[model samples]
Target chain A: MQYIKIPLVLAAVLILVIVFRNRQRVELRAGSRVLVLALAAIAIVSIIDPDIPQAIANLLGVTRGTDLLLYLLIVVFVLTSLGLYFRLRDTDQHLRRLVRSLAIDDAIRKDGPPRSDADLGPDSQST
Target chain B: MESGPTRRNDDVWVIVPCYNEGPVVRGVLERVREHFPHVVAVDDGSRDNSASEIAAAGARLVQHPVNMGAGAAYQTGIEFALRDPEAQIFVTFDADGQHRVEDVMAMVDHLRKSDVDVLIGSRFLGTVDGMSMSRRALLRAAVVFERMTTGIALTDAHQGLRVFRRSFARVLDLKAHDMSWASEFLTRMSEHQTSYEEYPVHVLYTDYSRAKGQRSINSVNIGVDVLINKLLRGR
Candidate 1:
């Protein structure tokens, strides 16, 4: 019963992911899918062979498998936080680029005259 | 500064893509208004007063109700420029003030004389004074990566300061919604066999721009997207 519970939960999660993917509103990338599959596979393997959890716990200097699960969750959370940080940084860069583009376009729109070619230095010329 | 030969006015449309740039949007728009008469600012669903500020600056504004990626905003601006009969050339300028107003003329001149469809700005071509060493190195690495991946020789592959002729701009199917759009643009140019040039330009990295700079990890995300686009999207 204990072994069956892990696979059953994983199967449920997989089904849910598939259903969400089929809706097409939010499609997971192949890399993300692979990550999810790997996670599920690890969960299944740990369930089928109870010794795996004990080994992980011993490796981590923990006495209980539950402690191992807790450590794993903490690691996952840390990674998720790192991912979010990167995402926000990307958003900030995109915003700045957009703002700069708008500013230059605005400048050109207000001034009707073409800039003199002499204004641009020789080094500025396109190759 | 020695001036190059002047080109016709009908050949270029300067595109500015903005998002929530309420404070400085007015100034940037005003500058564009003064220099490039044919300017289009695509408001990428700015949550603030960006769209209104752009409209107030006397430039044509294309508003996206929600914030799409910079790539989407550029595509919107390009579509607007392509619709105009006078827009024979399209230039992508940032809403921030990193790119100089004078550099646009140089790019346009190069595009007009050379048998090329695209002109990119290269900060490394000449002396780069105001940029940080870290940024300079990172940008150089990105350029090398792009050259290896796309087989296009460019001094600055990711610079936003670029000019494209109508013939090349019209055929581009730029689908990337994020910063990877820059790479996607290069990939499209390579696929279409569009002629291109790299022009040297000054990149002013102000405190504001530095604060808004992307972390190095985002480059990894962009790299992943590039690989996916090339391998999966088959671009």
Candidate 2:
């Protein structure tokens, strides 16, 4: 009966995630998808064999399963941070290209020829 | 065959794409007139007095009714320049006074001597001063990434100061509305096997230039644009 409950919960969560994935604004990246799967596995394993949580808690010198959950939350937060970092890096590259193109466009529109430092006054001269 | 001086006159049309640059538009026009006699400035629907300033400066003006991206403006300028029979080379100049006039000459010389179809300005080639450290780092990373993706070992892949031969420019199908046009250009150039040269050019990073800049956060939006255009739109 106990093993049956674990599989049932796992199936329910998987269906819920699939349904929500389509509607959610923040779609999961490949890394996040892997993390989520790993988490789901852990959740299912915990339900099927509750002693696993107690064993992890003991390994970490924690007294309760809730303490183990707290550690897992920290791990999740770290993974999310890593995901955000990669996303931001991708954004930075995109912006650099945009600025370069815009700058060139602005220059081209004004019928301006390319300018040297001598044109911008001596103070504005690039070193 | 005509002499070297006469042959030089047969090539090169300066293409300028202008937006809301009312203040310094006149200066840019005067500079181009002094150096390259044939210059065309395309006004990309500036809400400001950029168009009038361009006309007053006495350069041919191609106007777009609504504000389009730089890539669109460049395309317009190229189309107009292509109409001229004397224009054998089409050079893209920035209106913001960042690129050097001498670089255009150098690019022309390089294209004429070499078998390359396009010559791009590279700030990282020889010496680059007055660039912010953060900007330099960002640009270096982008150059590496672009080189990796396109297999083109260019020092400065995104520099807008480019000189394209009339023949190559005519065949290019540049349809990018926004900044992704630079990447698109590289992708196309590689696909078409267009020979290109990367020449060193100066980059002047002024307070005004940086102030009238896009926010760093907009990079995410640009990345999304690239992914969508490349994958979803099948471009």
Task: Name the best candidate (by lDDT).
Answer: 1
Q: What is the Cα-based lDDT of residue A78 in candidate 2?
A: 63
Candidate 2, which segments miss by more than 4 Å at Cα? Answer: A1-127, B1-10, B232-235
lDDT of 2 by residue, B1-235 (tens): 1233322433567878888888888788877766665677878878899988988886777677666677877877776666555568888898877777777877787788898898888888856657778777777776776786567778886788898887788777566666767777787787789988788888776676676655556555656665544442321
- Show model 1 residue runs off by greater than 4 Å: A1-127, B1-8
Alpha carbon deviation, residue B216, candidate 2 (Å): 3.1
**TM-scores for all predictions:** 0.64, 0.62
DockQ versus reference, model 2: 0.04
True-vs-predicted CA distance for residue B59, candidate 1, Å: 0.8
Best by DockQ: 1
**Candidate 1 lDDT over residue span A21-68, tens digit each:** 342233444655777788899899998998998898898789999888
User: DockQ scores for all the models shown?
Assistant: 0.05, 0.04
